[model samples]
Target: MLRELEKAEQKWGGANKAIDQWLNNRRNLLVHYCRIAGLPPYENGNSLPSVDNVRSFCEMLVDYVSEGHFEVYNQVVSACEKHGQTSKAVAQQLLPKINDTTDAALDFNDKYTEAADDKVLMQLDSDLSRLGDAMETRFQLEDQLLEVLHTRHS
Candidate 1:
């Protein structure tokens, strides 16, 4: 997973540094999540994920979402327009799914914002699972947009 993200950064980083950085942040967030969920190396241990790790993940999650919505999406739209492509149609088609993903992400953030206790963190397993699915959907949508708006033009 980490290597795949690194390759994506190498491929697309120069085109948009902000998106590259956000991808790197997402990689880190996934690592932290894996540790918390005991997926691999941490699976041998019985310890819960540290609050600091969860906190960092939550913060990065919000930043990634914000950058995607406010910066990266705008850049793609602008690029499509500059290239004489009909960005409006594409944006309109994608808006609903994007908005749904945003809502899910924000809800995840809100749920974890005050999770300082172990009980709260434990309860987050289900929400986090749902978040992982939402993020996958969001990434696929964003990648599709990039393919049309950035890759083709480039």
Candidate 2:
């Protein structure tokens, strides 16, 4: 469990770094574009990025989603197995949620180019909101499983 936790932590850290880099690049791109175009960099509570911006965001987003599916979740499943928890059943429970997240991510990727429009941006917001809620549920499920493992082992 500890090893798996360590691996997951490392993957999460990598994702964090990637997000940071993407954000910095994105900021620079927007600033440069605005300067060249003689327009102020867009601000005013806009949530979604432009098509190019969303494309860049989706690159890192894909990375995170891939890690979540193959690395982090796999580690969690392995932890459950090593500790004799409901590895199989828990994985079954998690599969659809993971699939939902992955599918949503793919949808975002596909629509990212079209997301500059207000309607598309609104859809992106809705998709992202769902993704956020799904991730929270995953976190809670992992916490619950960890508590059970700790209680049994400790």
Candidate 3:
């Protein structure tokens, strides 16, 4: 898992700098998420995540999603439009899938908005698992958008 994440962090760069920066934010968010979920290095013995870790992840998660939806998506669409009609058509076709993932991400964020104590974190195990699945889907969709709309056009 860690290896895959590291690979993704490095793979989606050099084409569009703005998209690279946005992908870096995604990488950082995943690192924080791995820590909170006690994956690999974070899983040694009783190295459960502290409340601070969870809180930080939640904060970063919101910021990342917001930027993706409001800034990065718009930039991608604009770039695709500038590229040509075919690029714009491809972006339009993929947008609804991307929007669905955004809605899922927002719902996940809402579940953790009031996460104030350890109990809440404990209860979040299932939600986090579901979030992992959602994030995987979102990442794949976003990568497709980057490839079709940004990298190819660039």
Candidate 4:
């Protein structure tokens, strides 16, 4: 995922301001996720992440998701409309999938954010795994949307 992010940054980093900033946030979000998920390099080898870490990750997660919907997705979709039918078709196809992932993300935020105590801690690992899958799906769909928009308009 980190490597994918680097490639995305290289591909679209200078393409648009909104996209660039969103990708940066994405990198931070991925790092926080890996830290919590205990996925190599960022792993603490611990069973569960600290409550503070979980709260921080949830905050970043929502910010990343919101920015994608409000800022980056809108820009890409607008560009798609300007290009042609094929681009529009790609965006339309991806939008629903992206929205599905958004629901998963918001659910994660809801579950973890209200965790004022460690009662949610028992299920944190499984929840993080599910959220990771959703995040990965979202990243792929978003990349596809950007690819269509940029390829057509470039």
Candidate 5:
């Protein structure tokens, strides 16, 4: 039983490590997206996108967001819950951050739908700012925990 517990703990540790890395990457992407978001919609090509074009691009972005922040994140959170780990609390706290990111993306979509002169950049900027803000908080929490653990274990 002791060995099993040790293994489980290690696995959870590994999972959280992965999540931290992924979240960092996601945050970076959001920053990058924001940098370009201020460009006008037509700023890309100065032409109106077809319905299909918009739908496909939006779908892809949503899928990407879900896969990273929801799908994989939820899997790790569930594992933590199953193991009765403190990760459960971490996961719960992080969930709202994910929602904030999602909301930003939705807001961008809403504005994109009605943007005049195809200036969709402002909406995209808003969305990225929201997502980046959430990511910053999540990463800070993770870093603080790591520092505490290091102090305790060292």
Candidate 6:
């Protein structure tokens, strides 16, 4: 996920102000995810992620998704309107799938925000895995939107 994000930045980092900010948000959210999931350099799985870490991840997760819906999607749609039908069609197709991912993210946030018991902690790894998959899908959809828009708008 992190590697994909870096590649995305390389490809579309400065294409526009909104995309630049959205991708930066993605970077921060993925870093927080890595820390909580104990992936890579954060892999100190001798213990569960600290409560503070989980809380922070949930906060970042919500904020990231909020920006996508409230800011990025609108910007993408507006850009597409100034272009061709293909871009408009692409945006229409992709945005709904992205919304599904948002639901998954919000579900994860709600589940873990107040989690403090062994039972809840026991689900963290699996939940993270599911959320990771959803996020990967969402990122691909978002990039497709950006690619289509940038091709025409740029």
Error of 3 at 96 (Å): 1.9
Candidate 4 Cα lDDT to native: 0.89
- Predicted structure 4, TM vs. truth: 0.95
Tell how far residue 21 is off in model 2, in angstroms: 14
RMSD in angstroms, candidate 3?
A: 2.3
lDDT of 1 at 154: 84
TM-score of 6: 0.95
- Please provide TM-scores, in order, for all candidate models, with all chains considered together: 0.83, 0.52, 0.85, 0.95, 0.47, 0.95
Worst 10 residues of 6 by lDDT: 114-123
User: What RMSD does each model have against the real structure?
Assistant: 2.3, 9.1, 2.3, 1.1, 10.0, 1.1
Please write out the lDDT profile of model 5 over residues 1-154, one tens digit for every residue.
2232233344334545655455444444443443343333324443344444444445545655666665566555556566555656665766666566566566555655455543554344455566446545544544443333333332
lDDT of 3 at 138: 78
Model 6 clashing-pair count: 0
Q: Give me the displacement of residue 103 in model 6, in angstroms.
A: 1.4
Kindly list the per-residue Cα lDDT of model 3 for residues 70-138, writing each as its tens digit: 898899989889888888888888888877777766776776776677777666667788888877887
- Model 1 local distance difference test score: 0.74
Instruction: Report lDDT per candidate.
Output: 0.74, 0.52, 0.76, 0.89, 0.49, 0.88
Q: Rank the candidates by lDDT, best first.
A: 4, 6, 3, 1, 2, 5
What TM-score does candidate 1 reach?
0.83
Number of the predicted model whose lDDT against the real structure is largest: 4
- For candidate 1, write residues 59-130 as lDDT tens digits: 888988888888878887777777764665676577578779988888878877777677877766788788
- What C-alpha lDDT does candidate 2 achieve relative to the native structure? 0.52
Q: Which ranges in model 2 have alpha carbons more than 4 Å from their true place? A: 1-43, 46-48, 85-88, 113-123, 138-154
Better of 1 and 2 by lDDT: 1
